[model samples]
Target chain A: MQTPSATLVSRFAMEVASACFVMAIGALVCFGAREFGIGWGDAGPQPGYFPFYVGLIIVIASCGVLVQALLQRRDRRESFLTREQGGRILAFFGPMLGFVVLSVLLGMYVALTIYLCSVMVVQGGYRFHKAAAISVATAVISYVVFEVWFLVPLLKGPLEAWLGVH
Target chain B: MENFGNLMDGFGIALSFYHLALMAAGVLLGILVGVLPGLGAPNGVSLLLPLTFTMDPVSAIILLTSMYWGALFGGSTTSILFNIPGEPSSVATTFDGYPMAQQGKATQALTLAFMSAGTGALFGVVLITALSTWVAQFALKFSSPEYFAVYLLTFASFIGMGSASPFKAVVSMMLGFACAAVGMDGVSGNVRLTFGFTALISGISFLVAVIGLFGIGELLQTMEEGLRFEGLHARINIRDVFHAIYTLPKYWVTLLRSALIGCWMGITPGGPTAASFMSYGLAKRFARNKENFGKGDPNGVIAPETADHSAGTCAILPMLALGVPGSATAAVMMGGLMIWGLTPGPMLFIERPDFVWSLIASMYLGNVMAVVLVLATVPFFAAILRIPFSIIGPMIVVVCFIGAYTIAGSTLDLWLVLPFGILGYVFKKLDYPIAPMVLAMVLGDKAEDAFRQSMIFSKGSLGIFWTNSMLVASIMTIAMLLLFWPLIGKLIGRLRRAI
Candidate 1:
């Protein structure tokens, strides 16, 4: 049977592994950039050279640490994240991920309205009417401030043309 | 006499209605942000920068500078009234301040904190007023090697003071340096990190990164913890204020020491956090009621409050004199300076005396305003804690997204915000110090530019760094100290054992 300490160690090992995976992807991007004929001094050095090297280093270092953490002996300790704590992380990360997806499809204003309302309702536990009212008002005000008054062309997706914002 | 003339000119600009109004607005907004936990001066200033696009350079500088001072003052308010510190720099105040509040000396603690902050700010402003010219002249001597040496010192200190393992700090710092290397290479004007995205050409804005790292990252943290506000019910009476003032003379030595430490730390680029910690530690060791230090000593609150404010104020010195920002807030201010097309350096004093001096003078006025405003409104500000965090939490997230998008009018920026927020959360969980990462990110490109420039000048030989005695000495000293840190730690341990 696995001990509690062993479980914690295993969890930490998994996290290190995930971090390494991300770093590996970053390294691939760097390598691909290098292969695309971006040299250190081409046109004063391509945009990818420094960041490429940096990403490569991160991958190497992250892998080393991942291996070290996996091989380390387990020590008994309390879990840093309990199930409840994990739930809280998901509560935040889930809606945020949804917002990013929505933004691309629904446009910034509509997506913002939905995002704000959901957060206020789900995370804040606000009354439906109050959260909905606040969300809509905030989005409108921001649109006026940034788009109309400042003359910044906010990213208007196909939906905005459908809605005749122009 | 020359100093007097410069100050008079500074006053003329500062007293103008346009500058004065901007300064007042900055102070008010700064206080609001600084009083809120997790929103400190840097975030506050960065958030407000876009608003300054419409402002004249002079008005913008005054506003941002006043905000910086106000944030420093406001940070101490929460530490005195509640156990929570509004910012990292105010952490030391919570040690003794909250205990004093618990003992029903809330008014006295608030008054002392405000007054000390004001005094420290005044000292810092005066130092800048007096020494800026000399400092600028001296900083002009700095070549690329010298700059790289300073950058090295900054990273080294993070490792020295960080709670995280040295390896983690180094890795975090390298990550920041790498991030800084994104966009076009400064020396060669070649794009290095864009990875074929045209949007990446202009490069990632430091403001965008800062907004994501501090603003969005903080929202993520709050979401995880389920934001909760603890309210305080206390009436601040005038009698307590007077009582604190009467007792002020008793802690004169502590006050002076703290002010000096604050000024030194500010000038050296360590900033308010270092000054506050050093001041608090020294105060605890030397205070008359040393045993009662942690429990609640008035000196404990006074020392940190004084030092933090002073350091915050003095950080402007390097910005004005050398165009080198000592802190993140100052970096944002530098951005403002560049937007206005006014280069911050020795010429700022020579050519734009009105702008430079007026900003310095306003610090004097702004500090007084902050003290009076905070003291009079302590009860009102403390009542903010009574507001439900459920409402505040969602509001903060909305603001973070808007702030990010507003920087460039791009959803890509807003999208980047979440990943950085997660990164921040991971760093926090791992107990890695974020300060080094931030400092390195802000200074990394400049440091790299300096290194490469020096190499080019020396025909690709690294020996140029040693050719300059100042650069050689500073670099060698820091390298030696960092390499020998374990030995120093061991020696300190031995001394403790012996004692």
Candidate 2:
């Protein structure tokens, strides 16, 4: 079996998928517009008037793109992403997801430190102490810039509350 | 004459120590970010826009516009020294810049590029002084019909001028309008399209969308390629700067020609990138030393640099006077204007004279600052390129996430960043342009409002758009332009062949 990283999605598949997504959104918007009343009112045109045309245009354009994608021969289709590139994307995506969750739970400063250190260690293969130093430095500097100086409120968690930083 | 007096007053504010300091800091930040791979002026401006919330609108615009100047200037250094353009606009600079660097005149090439850029920028500011006021005055007569027509012209230009398929561009634009529609319908007082979600009641924040689509989206895209920067070493001495300045007056013809081309391109919405390439090609064809054009010709570096900077600066004129931003970066600035509660259009010229004129004056001062700052700190900015993308990539994401969160100070914004980021990545990979999306999101509400008002005024007579002589003439011009699209395509194709 081909490796996940090496797996390729055909261009036709991507095009059709995107086109279908657009068409679905278009249909939903159009349905909403009709319900909202797409006509002239006593004071002015109804609120839905502009949206109805916008939705129609989207559906028609998406259909055209859909047809274009479907009619193309298999040999003519281009490759969207190679398996290796896909793997590399997921490598970044996984940590980003983790970082988002961590920030939600642990606070931005704490999460940033961990995120940077982990990236340095896992991705760049740096020593733990060195990674920690840089991460700490970055987190502290960002804290000064965004929190202290700017005085902008930030989303924080237990760690910040414990440190009395927030 | 009154314009001059106002410009003088504008200079009064622009020259203030606080404004000057902000301008310098912005240019410095701009150069650093522009030097980084996968970051440029629009991303820099959008990322920093949240910080400007506490500052007055004048200082805010000065800072952002200065960043634009610095980014354009910094873009050339990489192009000249390393043949790595920070953005597409600088790609033309690489044609002769790298060759000159290879010939060991890298300092001279950088200096000439900076000087030519400053000259072109000054020229664009002069155009603003001479032209924008008249346009603003002219726009004062406009009613909703005319306003709708102008909006249509801006949208139609994207369809006509873009390299993307017209259908796809429209789809992208429609998607933007759909996102815009989610917010409360201002007229009806009904919160349409919210789908009953409490968070959806306020709608998708354009600032959040920008941060997500550009900042986080870009970070992911950069990571997908791993490490890609192979930066060149650069050094510039005082002697090289003086020598380059001394030799500048000798290429006056090329300079003037390039400046005019830049001005035309910027105002016509040809965009800086296109202007740069078109100028470079024209220079090569027109130069007296045609045979030596590619072989480290200094004029080769001057033409594109001048055109690119001029186009970038002059793009603001249309953005300021018409509310229709001509470039993606300008669109971000327009979004900033909206966020700051300033409706950008001709009315701004009347209502916010100090803000508008001071921004114009700051463009002049900022270009000077950009040149001085870039010349002194080339090696410093270049060193940033040496850092691994693996390290830089995650840091940018952190900044983007923070920026997104701080917009409304909620975890919701953090979550909001991802889907938009993913969409941006997909759009970039699919070669569907993202500029139209951002522009549409920003202008969709205003355009729709204008259309509704126009219909009311016309009493549902579709002919109202053509009722007045000026409106009729304007609409006819746009129609003629659209009608001749096929002919224009063929002509452009033939020209490409001949070239």
Off by over 4 Å in 2: A1-7, A68-77, B287-296, B483-499
| TM of each candidate vs. truth | 0.88, 0.93
Q: Please, what are the lDDT tens digits per residue for candidate 1 over residues B164-253? A: 566566667667776677676666566666768887776677676677677666666665555555545668888888988888878888
> Candidate 1: which stretches are off by over 4 Å?
A1-78, A140-166, B161-163, B470-472, B483-499
lDDT of 2 by residue, B1-499 (tens): 9899999999999999999999999999888777765677777888888888888999999999999898898889888877778766898999899899898898999999999999999999999988888999888888788887877777777677767666777788888888888768877876667666778777777777777777667777767765576655788878988999999999998899999999987876667887898899899998877888778899999999999989999889989998878777898899889889998888998899999999988988998999999999998887877777778888888888888887777788899888888888787777677777887887888888888887888788877778755765576479457535645888999999999
Clashing pairs in 2: A5-A83, A5-A84, A6-A83, A7-A83
lDDT of 1 at B482: 71
Model 1 per-residue lDDT at B65 = 85
Candidate 2: chain B TM-score equals: 0.93
Kindly give the number of clashing pairs for every candidate. 8, 4
Model 1, residue B446: distance off in Å is 2.0
* Candidate 1 RMSD to the correct structure: 4.1
